[model samples]
Target chain A: MGRAIRQAPGRAPRTTRSLAHARFLLALTLAVVGLVLIVMLAVTIGPANVSLAQVSGSILGHLGLGATGTDSGAVPLLIDSIVWELRLPRVLTAAIVGAGLAVSGAVMQSVTRNPLADPYLLGLSSGASLGAVCVVILGVGFALPAAAFLGALAALFATLSIARVGGTITPARAVLAGLAIAQLAGAGTSFIIFWSAKGDSYREILNWLLGSVAGATWNSVIISGTALALVGTGVVLAATRLDAFAFGDTAAASLGINVNATRWALLGSVALLTGAMVAVSGAIGFVGLILPHLVRGLSGPSHRRLLPLVAVCGALFLVVADTLARTIFDPRELPVGIITAFIGVPVFIVLIKRKKSSAWS
Target chain B: MVVAVPGSTAGVVIENLSFSIDEQVILAGVSASVAAGTVTGLLGPNGAGKSTLLRLVGGLATPASGSVTLGGDEIGAMPRREAARRIALLEQNTAPSVDLSVEDVVLLGRIPHRTRLLGTFGGDDDRAVAAESLAAVGAGELVDRMWHTLSGGQQQRVQIARALAQRPSLLLLDEPTNHLDVSAQLSLLSQVGGLGTTAIMALHDLNLAAAFCDHILLLQDGKLVAAGTPAEVLVPEIIGEVYGVECDIIEHPRDGHPVIVFSAPRTAVAPMRAAASA
Candidate 1:
């Protein structure tokens, strides 16, 4: 065993027993600092020429601190309003949405004990899309995302129901059910979009298909961000149980996880986060699918390590993806969803080619 | 690490425990008492119901017509976590997950005792016993390694350590040494028997079972054909009647235990096959 440890490579020359512990601590410390920097950069980069001070001041004020609306109490409120009221919300929402999606993906992957199990593949985003579309186009229902939220919850429960038989959920059954239900919901959505028959409605729905932060507002951002923090932290704090989940059901059961209860808790939280994010930003893909996997490669697959790692990486990944989406096409901005897949795919392909880490055994 | 809670009786007892699956009677009508502080070997052949009986005992599978009592109480009535803490079962070929670390896998054994939702692995929760559990089967160094990277024999030992970490009063292991080498096989049985914890294991190796078991329960097609001390149950006549093989049951010189000397079955006139023309 000592020989194997020595052979693992990429360690300090001394290679004491404490080295792996030291490396983990270092990875955690660096990840935390890097996350803070990404948050600032994400908030700062935009088409609007808001100074860094203005960005910090608005953030501080939003946090209910003593920060003034104006940077030096000299500039007029006009520029501050543009920075605070307009671009800031979108950037913050991107981080919140990213964190929620990644954590959801991580938790989902653990619960199913299938590496391929992520929130997107389970039809959650598509379900949210169906709900949002129903409310927006039908004009007969509720708030913009509330309808979508319900849809995500419905899809989550439906999938669990389909997979479960006699109190046990097998990996084969779960993937099969998810594939069937996701396809079914997606077909229903396409039918609704085509049947709507109005050109303006088509464009609006199309814009949504390419998830945007164009409708970002402080109210929606606060709601989504708060939900993300509350639920995401809750999931992280429950990290140990999530780690047990990676051991599969009977082992987990003997380990005393009420397998059914744990499954429901993870699924409920994931569905809620997915619904809220999809409500705010339409159907952003790849961040949930790809970011968690990337983070796992850097840090191994311990959820205690994986969740926080993925949360930061997912936030940074989406924020950067959104920025590229806005900048790469200039005035004719591409949808953030387009940017995520466009950027996410090549990295994903490379990761696959390297065979350094497989999401599955 | 095995603790006896006040009023917590930790032995397993079966009374008329019959079970059927897919309309097939597996354990027809079985009754046995695996007393506290002894290792009971459930000895059987391929089609026997030893595994089924152990599953019912572990609370993994419900019996069709009877109950398995644990700690002198019906297992169905024991609180879920309470039951888990008192009894740990290890089955064969646990589909290894590549991503989990060995420590992460072992911490799972402590879950039944953890009341907090997060199940923090504090110093006490590390199962200071985990080290001993690992060392008993010689898997202590595998603690930090990724679980999937371990060799098959090493993996099996780690699993026993996990069950040991559970601090179970009654440990049930099913065919635990299937992939293990000879030394590992003897070493693991000695550890379990040495623990003085009540262990009822379904072991395929009759010789190993005879060497370690304080009591042997021979099952033929799910019925308890015979039971008692190893010497009493592992007789040459009983072995021939149950296994339908010619064998010699002799005293093991070193341990003064009964050992089997297997012999080829006597040839009988073949029941004629259908004629090729037909």
Candidate 2:
């Protein structure tokens, strides 16, 4: 009946616009490959002079894949221990933490409809730090990861309650509430450290606060890896629904999405993911904030494309950053968070300056 | 084919709907019915609850009391995805902070048709519908353009295209012509009028309502003050009583529809003469 409005001269014909999909697939493939290569390269670059071949041989031999004709006797046991025991766990833990934090950040940005939102914006990191520090100083019987997750959930509830006024959560109010909780949690963390921490334990708490993977073990790898698979996959699968939120709550609700429920679920998922990562990594900063922004430049704003790509890129970025943090100072080590910020700030500024136009105003 | 009549089971019926937030009522006991295959105008001044009524019908908000039925089915009882497949709402002043291409923005309308885990069960069909909707709204050429780059009218047109992509039977719009120029407004309304779907649009321009709407519902202070054909409801008394302004209604020579000409308020409150009585 409305055919009259369809008249236009020389209109472009609709072609199969599969190019974007092809590009996305290509990016995903590249990211997967890049992560593998970066992990391989990062494990080789540690203070122990493990060559690429020996590292591969050790990994293959451990996997029960026979080493490719390399002399097993030539590869020393200590180097194998350094590669397999020390560096590999740390690198894998960094990668998982990166992926989880990046996914959490992307989901947070989409749910809040705020471009600047990151995993830590809801006071997750500070709360987790508080939990971790309490366990460290007070010699609590509870596991640090469990305590940290609970603390993050507590902070989330507090932030949500404060932000929600008259049944609406404005972004400004949420950010403000998060800041308040973060500061409160940070003060508590500092107070616990000041009052109860003794000697080397204070150093331990300091390293945790600054976010180091120096003490990462196979346990950390298993914990962060499981969290990433369970919660991160859920967030990625929920990407389509997240796209509905681009316009705002009303439009999303009209599209048949239960906006409030979806928002709460997504928020809770992010909190869980971030809490798990923080429990393992002690609140590594900048990866959550910058990786999503950087990946968005390549994948555009579609979470379907952005989530997996950001996960991989974040993994690569953190693996590289952690490798540098441990090896750059030779005998001494720095917190990985310091390295991420040092590298991330410049890269972020460059990205901001390089873009002629932004998706957001 | 049996020609479906307007105001049939496919139409929308809102009965005694009331909504309040924080002890402030937004819509009160508003009852109205719109017929299928006709354009209905929701005419009201600012804060008159036109948007709220539309929201209730779109199933975005629940009425505190009473019910909304679409096609003889209670809307609140319908599954959200099922209801979305039938109805689309175009809201006012929605400037998304995200950067999305026009095509992607329109593709959002296909969400209701998509699976929960994986979106757009039929990708090719969804893309075609989005393209056709963009063309339907005269935004076909802007398909590749980023949303932030579009002008206000173009953005509005793209928003309409997004809504159209849903392939809805009942479309609700809030001030759909707020950003359009005069010519664009006329053409947009003409396009909507010819769509053959039941459309309930909240409008501020009384002349446009008179020209395009088959039925008019006038609201004042959350109450339905008048409802009928435009000729019956656009009378001066109802207009003045609701809008608090004096207005003259003239018949358009071309279409024989009522065109309102507004004037200053008939009663001007005089300043208190220096509290003379005190």
Evaluated with lDDT, which candidate comes out highest? 2
Per-residue lDDT tens digits of candidate 2, residues B112-221?
Answer: 88888967532778877887777776677788788978877778878877887777888999998997799888977877776677899999999999999999999988
- What's the CA error at residue A332 for candidate 2, in Å? 1.7
Candidate 1: TM-score of chain A is 0.82
Worst 10 residues of 2 chain A by lDDT: A352-361
Alpha-carbon shift of residue B176 in model 2 (angstroms): 1.2
User: Per-residue lDDT of A1-361 in model 1, one digit per residue for the tens?
Assistant: 1222222334232243246447666777787677666666666666666677766666666677745645455334765677677777877788778888888888887887655566666778778877877777677468766777788888877877898898766655665776677677666666777787577555556455657776779886977887788788888777777766665676776666677787888788888888888888877776776777777756666576688878877777777777777778677667788887786668656644554344322
Per-residue error for A235 in candidate 2, Å, reads: 1.1
Which segments of model 1 are wrong by more than 4 Å? Answer: A1-29, A61-75, A140-146, A157-177, A199-203, A206-210, A297-302, A343-361, B1-10, B20-28, B62-65, B122-127, B236-246, B263-278
Model 2, CA-based lDDT: 0.80
Interface RMSD of each: 7.1, 4.7
Query: What value does the lDDT take at residue B262 in candidate 2?
Result: 77
**lDDT at B125 for candidate 2?**
82
Segments of candidate 2 deviating more than 4 angstroms: A1-16, A67-74, A164-173, A345-361, B1-9, B267-278
For model 1, give the RMSD to the true fold.
5.6
lDDT of 1 by residue, B30-130 (tens): 98887788899999888799888877887766787778887667875676677788788887855654565676566667767776565655345364556
Tens-place lDDT digits, model 2, residues A1-361: 4443444646543442456667778888998999988898988885567788878877886777755334654456787788888888989999999898888888887888765566565677778788877776787987877778778878888987998898877666776788799889877887888787567665566566668888889999998898899997888788889999989888998888999799989988887788778887886776777888878867877788899899998898888888888888978888888898787668656644644243222
